[model samples]
Target: MDRKHRGACLCNRVQFEVEGNFDSFFLCYCEHCRKDTGSAHAANLFSRSATLNWLKGRESVRTYRLDKTQHSKSFCLNCGSALPTHDEHLNLLVVPSGSLDTAVDIKPDARIFLGSKAEWVDKLDCIPGFDTLPQLER
Candidate 1:
């Protein structure tokens, strides 16, 4: 049976469903990825055969492609949350892992572009973890 995954934007302005299994999951530390996510890395799932269907708010979706680069991102114009982008040139579908409302069955295959990884990313395991926001000290 084929797998299906549903997702929505932060504001719930955009909703979609991907109707195929992901080919690979990658944590990318490239400079463009870092800037796109505003974090240490970008967790994205890639699929060559998957089809993206916009369930709702299709008009609210917008895509931005960097000039002179293959880098592109699709997002909800209302909340600026990352959404799935289908690259016609590559014939690939790229989905942001966090945007999915359903559970992901696949683990990340690899971390790419490690040379551009943030300095603080390496020490993340050594830092304190919290279940929720910790109270500020008086």
Candidate 2:
């Protein structure tokens, strides 16, 4: 049986279901990915055979394709959360890992575009971590 995953936008305005297992997971640190996610890297699951179905609030989803490039992203217009996008040219479905409400069983297969990674990325492991928001000096 094919694995199924459900997800929603930050505001829960949009919901979707992905059917089939992800063929690969990747942490992309390219400049374009960083700009798209506003983060150090983008965790994405890629599958060529999987299907994406919007279960609710489909109208709230908008896709942006970068002109003169294969880069593209789909997001919720309401909450500005990343959503899955299908690349017709590549025949692949790219899903942002964080958008999935369901737990992901697979780990990232690789980290790509290390040359474009943020300067602070290498020292991230040395930073203090907090379970929740910890008290900080102002």
Candidate 3:
């Protein structure tokens, strides 16, 4: 039996699903990943056997590729949320972990591009953790 994972964009305009197990997971700290996610790193799940099916709003998804590099990302045009994109060259499907609405059984396999990580990223554990958004000191 194939496992199904559901996902959607922030606006809920774009909905999708992936069937089959994820093969690998990675937290990428490369420059393109940081810029693509607007964060220190991008958490992505990869699979060569899984199949992606669009439930709705497939037209809302757009892909961007860097001019001189193979770095690319797919995002919802409405809410700008990350989505999965298939790499033809690698024959792999890469999905942003945060984009999924369902619980994931696979954990990250490794953190890549450590050399490109931000200096402050190493201090993440030292910072106070919050269950939810904390009150801002205005």
Give the Cα error of residue 134 in candidate 1, in Å.
Answer: 0.6
Worst 10 residues of 3 by lDDT: 63-72
Better of 2 and 3 by TM-score: 2
Please write out the lDDT profile of model 1 over residues 1-138, one tens digit for every residue. 569999999999899999999999999999999999999999999999989999999999999999999999999999999999999999999999999999989999999999999988989999999999999999
Off by over 4 Å in 2: none
Clashes of each: 0, 0, 0
For candidate 1, the per-residue lDDT at 116 reads: 93
Candidate 3 structure lDDT: 0.93
Error of 3 at 122 (Å): 0.8
| lDDT score, candidate 2, position 96 | 99
* lDDT of all predictions: 0.96, 0.96, 0.93
In TM-score terms, candidate 2 sits at 0.97
TM-score of 3: 0.96
RMSD of each: 0.8, 0.8, 1.0
Which candidate would rank higher by lDDT, 2 or 3?
Answer: 2
lDDT tens digits, residues 62-132, model 3? 99988878788999998899999988988889999999999999789999999999999999998899999
Q: Can you write out model 2's per-residue Cα lDDT over 1-138, one digit (the tens) per residue?
A: 689999999999999999999999999999989999999999999999999999999999999998998899999998899999999999999999999999989999999999999999999999999999999899
Using Cα atoms with residue i matched to residue i, what is each candidate's TM-score against the true structure? 0.97, 0.97, 0.96
* Predicted structure 2: lDDT: 0.96
**Which candidate order results from sorting by TM-score in descending order?**
1, 2, 3
